[model samples]
Target: MNETHAIAGVPMRWVGPLRMSGNVASTETEVPLATYESPLWPSVRRGAKLSMMVENGISATLVDDRMTRSVLVKADDAHNAYLAALDVAAQLEELRAIVRKCSRFTELVALRHEITANLLFLRFEFTTGDASGHNMATLAADALLTHILQSVPGITYGSISGNYCTDKKATAINGILGRGKNVVTELLLPRDVVHRYLHTSAAAIAELNVNKNLIGTLLAGGIRSANAHYANMLLAFYLATGQDAANIVEGSQGVTVAEDRDGDLYFSCTLPNLIVGSVGNGKGLDFVEENLTRLGCRAEREPGENARRLAVIAAATVLCGELSLLAAQTNPGELMRAHVHLERKSTSTTVGGW
Candidate 1:
C-alpha cells in the first residue's frame, strides 16, 4: 500500500479592516475568506465598510464557551440508570481531578445527562484552552467513563458518543444549551449611512428582516435558525482558517435581528455555536498557521484568550455577510443582478462594479 497527499485550493481574500470592540478583542483587521462563491468577498466588504462608519463598529461580545463530549452507559434497568446519574452528579470534584490527569488544558467545567429506559447519556463539558476541545473533551470523557463503570454498579459501557453532545448536527439542544463559543455581534448604523452604503433605508431593512427572515424561516420549519445565508459566510471563513468545516451545521444555526431604532438601523447576528480554535489538528498547515497569525488569533495571551478572539472574529464576519445579503434582498432584482454580473463567465466583471 502507498500513501499520498494533496491540497485543494479555495480562492481566498481579505475582506475588511472591520472595526471590532468587545471583551475578547478590540482592533481593526481584515478577515480572510476562502470560497468558490465570488460575490461573498465584495458582499462582506460592504458590511465591513458600514462597520467603520458606525460609532463602535461591531461590538462582538463572547457570552460563553465550552466543548462537549457525551458518553453512553447502559444500566441493568431504568432504576439503575437513574441511580448512576445521581452518583455521578455527587462526584463533580472527583471528575474534575480526573480530567486534570488527561490534559493540562482540559478542565471539567460542567456535566449534563439524559436517561431513557436503561440507557444513560452523560455529557461532559470542558474548557480546552486554545484548542477547539473536541479531542481534549473526548479524552477526558473516556477517562471519566472508565471510572464511572468501575465505581458505579450495574452499568456497562455503551458508546463514547451518545448523540446528546450533538456534534456537527443541527439540533435544538445545541442552541438551547450551547456546545461552542457563543458570540453576539451588533452594529448600529445611522439612517443615512444605511441608505448610502447598503442602498436601503433603515426601516425597510428592519421590516424585511421580520417578514422575510423571521416569518419565512418559521413557515419553512427551520429549527433554531433565522438568517439569509450564515452557512455561506461560515463555510468561507471556516475553510480559510482551518476549522472543522462540518461544524458549520450547528454554527449556521443563528438568529439575525434587525431593529429600526427610531430612524437608525440596529442590526445584530447571534451565533451560539461557533466552534473554532487557534491551536488544533487542522491548524498545523502553513496556510492555516499564516491565516491564524494574520487574524491575531495566534497570540501570547491567557489560556483561552486566543480561541475566544477567534470565535468573536468569526461572529463579526458572519454579521458582515448577513447584513450585506439582507440589504441586497431589500431591493427587487438587486440580488439576482449582482449574482448574474459577478458569476457569469462570459461577461468580464470587476470587484469595483460590485
Candidate 2:
C-alpha cells in the first residue's frame, strides 16, 4: 500500500492521484484530474485556482450575503391580514435595525409577503456574513416573530418554517427567486483539448447534453435541474470543506448548458442554491480549516466575501467534473470500466470488459 500524506505547501492529505516518477511517487496531483489519474480515479477526489477564478465573477448586488426566511402567521380575517401586513411593512425599518441588535453578524436586507384568506407568509432576506446563514436567518426571524407577536394585533404565530424559505428540499422558488450563492461557471475548451483530454468532440458532447440532460430530465420529471451527477461533485466538495452536506438537495438544483461554439466546446453550470461558508459551523475542524485556507477562501478582506469565493470555486469544480463525466459517457463502457479498474477490489479482470 502507498502512503498518503499532505502535499507540500498545500493543506490536503494524499487521498489519491499522486504524480509519479519512475517507480516512486513524488507530488500529489489535484482533484478531478486525480479522479482520472490516480488508481483510485474511480473513487474520486477533487477545487479552485486561477484558471477557475478567471471564469468566476462575484455578483456585486450583495448576492452572496443574502439569506431568506418565510414566517406564517394566522390572522382573524382578511381585514386582519391586511392590517397585519401594514404593521409588518411599517416596522420594516425597525426590524432591520432589530436584526443588528439581535444578531451580531446578521443584517436585514429585505422583507416581502404573500396574503391568503387569513394567512400571512412574510418572507425575510438578510446578509448573514461569513456563515451559510440558515441559522442566522432563523435567529433573525425569531427576533422578528417575537416583535410581531407583541406588536401586531389579532394575529397568532403559525410556523417559523413555512416552506416559503424553502430549506433543504428542492423547490421552484429557490430556482426562480434565488437562494444561497448564485454561481455560473463556463469553459471554452479547445477542439484539440476536447478530443485529447476529454476523449470526445465538441458537437458530440453538446448533442449528448441536449438529449441526456434536457430531454431525458424532462421525461423523468426532474425538479428544477437537468444535469449529470452534480450532487456527486457537490457532496465531495462539501465534505472536504465542512459545509452543510444536506444542502446538496437544493445545491444540486441547477442547469447544465453545453454548446459547440465554432470548434471549441462551451460548457457551463449555473447553480443557484450553493450554500457554503468559510466560517461558522464545521470550519473549526483542523482538516476543514486547512482545506479552506489552501483554497484561499479564508480571506480577511470582508465578512461574506470569503464565502463568495468558496462558492465560485465550487461552481468551477462542478463544471470540471461535469464536463469530464459527460465526455466519458460518450464512449461505451468507459465510465464503468474506470469504476471496475479503480473501485472494485476483486481479482477477476473480466468485469466491465476490462
lDDT of each: 0.91, 0.72
Candidate 1 has its poorest 10 consecutive residues by lDDT at: 345-354
lDDT of 2 by residue, 14-42 (tens): 33221211111122224322122232223
The residue ranges of model 1 lying beyond 4 angstroms of the native Cα positions read 345-354
Residue 101 of model 1 has an lDDT of: 99
The runs of at least 3 residues in candidate 2 whose Cα sits more than 4 Å from the true structure, single-residue gaps closed, are: 1-65, 345-354
lDDT measured at residue 14 in model 2 versus the true structure, 0 to 100 = 33
What is the C-alpha lDDT profile of model 1 across 35-151, one tens digit per residue?
999889889998888898876789999999999999999998999999999999999999999999999999999999999999999999899999988889989999999999899
